[model samples]
Target: MKPDTTAPLTFGMLVFDEVEVLDLGGPFEVFSTAGRLARTAADEPLLRVLTVAPTVRTVRARGGLTIVADHTLDEDPPFDVLVIPGGVTTAVERDEKVVDWLARRRRTSALTFSICTGAFLLAATGALDNRPATTHWEDQEELARRWPDVRLCTDVRWVDDGDIVTSAGISAGIDASLHVVARLFGEQLARRTARQMEYLWTDTRA
Candidate 1:
């Protein structure tokens, strides 16, 4: 589905305990930076990024970093894009609440983005079933083994399957997020956003 560029798109990022810092932070930075660069004195930003968690409590991310969510699952805040970042996802995978919430959101959101093993959570929601997807290289085999229905793509930074986009690993999320920026806005805006962040964006074709 094409994004309505006339207004800002809301990006809801899912965060949880043990979540990988770079996985979440990378995309957050990309979308937030893109929004800032796209904004003008007469117009609003191009995107609005929010952090959503199972609850609005302090989340202990990987490396002992703590984060507070802006919204929770129960609030059911609306978003145009859903960002799922990877980390130690065993507990998240086991949480039926999160899985169900993702499944529901995937149906309504304009785009669903998975970073690293975050693909596993999307897979749990069956969003990746029979879809071309990728994940952190080390976890590819396990993803394939568990979700035989997923058409796994190896040796790629990310896979863009229309509404769903999956990235290889932590830092790769930045690349994929920039690609999304280019897709939604334009390459010019995306390039400017990358330049503003001093990030060398590797734009890959979908």
Candidate 2:
């Protein structure tokens, strides 16, 4: 893995008040590590990971962990991959501004991804319409009731529908990120990265 100077993949994390901290941090860890490790063997860094919120300020997490976003929604440039992590999933799903951003950003990004209850927000964007996806299993029934357009899958860590992808809760975010790594640097590299990170994920190849 070398510095891919041509087109750097921008990884954007969408944060809202009370967002689950783990969902936001998990994939960020994987991709940032991948970028650093790749840089070690290549010319330039491969990822630009940043946290984004309504405005760059301290937003409290679900359990009262405060974080400072790197940029506000309007200030941040476009991202190749936008990750929406679940917080108060229902609250996020019902937010008008969050829905609007996701809808607009989906048009620009190569990939839009969600973790845990974040799938609820993605479904709100109508991006997952007619596509198979999954979220935290606890939210499936409610999600199905609310967004009937998405086909829910029960037995996988993640479902990637080309432009849109969703994963199960918490640690499943690690699997989803590894899926991105697999796509970017090949499966072997992804596996190596997973091993180096000491992450556990579903082995679809098995």
Candidate 3:
């Protein structure tokens, strides 16, 4: 689905215990910064980002960083995009509630994006079945083994399969997020956002 360019697109990022710090922070920084750069006197920011979790509680990230979610799954907050960040996802992948929630949300969201091993969670929901996707290089074999239906792409930093996008590892998420910004808005704005963040955008078409 094409995003409504006249208004801000709401991005709901999923957070859970043991989520990787940079996996969540990198894309958060990119989207937030891009929103700021896209804002003007007469318009709201191009995007609105918020954190969501299964419950309303403080989540401990991979490196002991704690984050409080802005919304809970019980609230069923509306969003145009869904962001899933990867870390220790063994438990999360086993969570039927969260996995089911993702499946339901994916149908209505304009985009569903995953970072690193977060692709596993998406795959659990059957979102990546028969779809081109990539993840952290270390986990590619496991992902392919676990979900044989998924078409794994090893060489690319990110794969954008229409509505679902997946990126490799932590830092690569930033590049993928910038690509999303460019896809939704324009490359000029994305370049400016990357420049503002002092990030060298490595790929625009990946």
Candidate 2 lDDT over residue span 123-156, tens digit each: 8888888899998878888888988988988867
Model 1, residue 177: distance off in Å is: 0.5
Superposed model 1: Cα runs more than 4 Å off: 1-5, 40-42
- RMSD of every prediction: 1.6, 2.6, 1.4
Model 2 TM-score, all chains together = 0.90
User: How far in Å is the alpha carbon of 87 misplaced in model 2?
Assistant: 2.0
lDDT of 3: 0.91
Error of 2 at 150 (Å): 1.1
lDDT of 1 by residue, 1-206 (tens): 55565778999999999999999999999899888877644488878899999876569999999999988899889898999999999998999999999999999998899999999999999888888999999999999999999999998999988999999998899999998888888889889989999999888732
lDDT of 1 at 186: 84
* Model 3 lDDT, residue 116, Cα: 97
lDDT of 2: 0.80
- Residue 106 displacement (Å), model 1: 0.5
What's the TM-score of each model vs. the native?
Answer: 0.96, 0.90, 0.96
